[model samples]
Target: MQDKLSKFEKAALLLLMLLAGIFGGLIRYFHLKYGFDALGLAVRGNRHAVILAALFALITLAFAVVIVLALTGRLFPKDAVAVGTIGAPTILLSALSALAAAVGTIVTLASAVKQLSVWGMLNGILFFAAAILTVPVVRKLSVRSDSASPIGTASLIIVFWSCFRLIEVYRTVSSTPSVSVYFYDLAALISLILMFFGCAGYLYGRSGAMRVYLTVAAYLFFGTVSLVGKGGLCLSALFSGAPVAMANVTDVCVYLYGFLFALAVIPTFFAPRRADPVAELIQAAAEPEESGKEEPPVL
Candidate 1:
């Protein structure tokens, strides 16, 4: 039954991902050719090539925030708030990365760094911090068998892996005396370990970390792959005019991949599971009986 549900989830998530990719492709294609000046963004040079970068970032942030909010109770559904406890720090982590990006973009131009290394590295730091900050919430929700654990884990894992380009940034900034190689190395190590634990949790039916790991790992691995490939193309497009077509094509493919990934993930989040309601009820029933028996019988 678990296997059956896993299979169904895989199929459904694939469809969700496929649709997202298709939508991404169409939107990117149009934006690259016509531009998104109305939305306060201009698709010039590599910017056109990386329109999908923003798309991926937006999707990831949205998913992460939603999951974190659900777990921490900041965004609980209906009147469910009084039932369980939620954490505030986790809620803040959910919202901070997006906030950082928005503020960073507004205050600092992308050109502040001569190399994509700096920008990429900063993103990695933000992502890692975001992921680490979420662990408490994910653990909290998961331990309680709440629905939000998988999402929380996934969000953190995704954030952790999505920062892969940080390696490149690390290499780039290695020469600068001010940059701490040790700091980044430590961060990288920590992220990888968390990612592994997250995946392990999922495979073992430890839904708290597993859900997070699966969601995060899928997004991180695929997202980083797509972004790294396209980020390079975007750089090329910025310098050369004729490669615009190639860049747009790359953008489309990335979108398609991302879309397919989403489709695959969403359903896993919903797939039916082997829940033991009877077992749960029995356990609950037994606990009280044991407690009452432990107390002195009515004097």
Candidate 2:
């Protein structure tokens, strides 16, 4: 049954990647000549969209291949569990996280340059550090022997980052509260909080971490809704003769983020419970010892 399920999952993943590739090709073909003006600069609209789609499709295909190989026990031979539990998903998530952080750093740096604000400079530096640190952290986590430590550290970092981002979103909303934006921010904030607690529980050897998969699923769902829904709204406005410019870069990032989250959730759902050495030791210690008395003839 497990083998059958694994086969099914691999087939589904391959199909998904194939579809992504086809969709990307179609979009590129249809929008080949599209162009637009942005900030007094002429931009190749179709080119950007085509590149984004192609890149997304390529990455998806690569990830699918990696997953298939891992599932087949061809990758990370000495650490199959780690590959399934953390390594594969970490590749996608960490790459996306780093990309997002890099974008944020660039934007913050630009803002600081324009405003000459010390705080903006500091914020930009922090973003840069996050972008640079993500790779090493993810690498360490991927190869770590114990899963709990890496997960706990990652979750804690996510919680803090999410809190900061949420605060920024709230401040923006307070000035001009849009329901859509607020909903997106709220979903993310809740997801991060749940993940934080879940990881914390797991680190402490509690079983409740298993339940956090639901929250992570919710997070991925809402994030998809927010990004795709916004894209849909942009299309609607465009068709309605509004001159709104959509950022393909952001769209690509969001797509990768959603895809990685979905994939990450899958392994988490199916991963076997790892044995806790401490818990086993305690159990053994608690067991009553057998008496060493000499046998009384009958024995």
Task: Give the Cα error of residue 211 in candidate 2, in Å.
Answer: 3.9
Model 2 — TM-score against the truth?
0.49
Shift of residue 180 alpha carbon in model 2, Å: 4.1
TM-score of each: 0.32, 0.49
Query: In candidate 1, how many Å is residue 17 off?
Result: 7.5
How many clashes would you count in candidate 1? 20
Candidate 1 worst ten-residue window by lDDT: 77-86
How far off is residue 63 in model 1, in Å?
4.0
CA lDDT, every model vs. true structure: 0.42, 0.48
Pick the lDDT winner.
2
Among these predictions, the greatest TM-score belongs to: 2
Backbone clashes in each candidate structure, one number apiece?
20, 0
Candidate 1: tens digits of C-alpha lDDT, residues 1-299: 75455445444443554455445544444443454345434535545336555665766576566557646645433322211222444344434433433433322223334345465445545444443443343333423443345454555454354344345445654665422212322232334344445533543345453344234434443343333444444655757874433443323232222323222233333433335577899999999888887656897
Write candidate 2's Cα lDDT for 188-232 as tens digits: 455545544554454444523323433444344444434444454
Inter-residue clash pairs, candidate 2: none
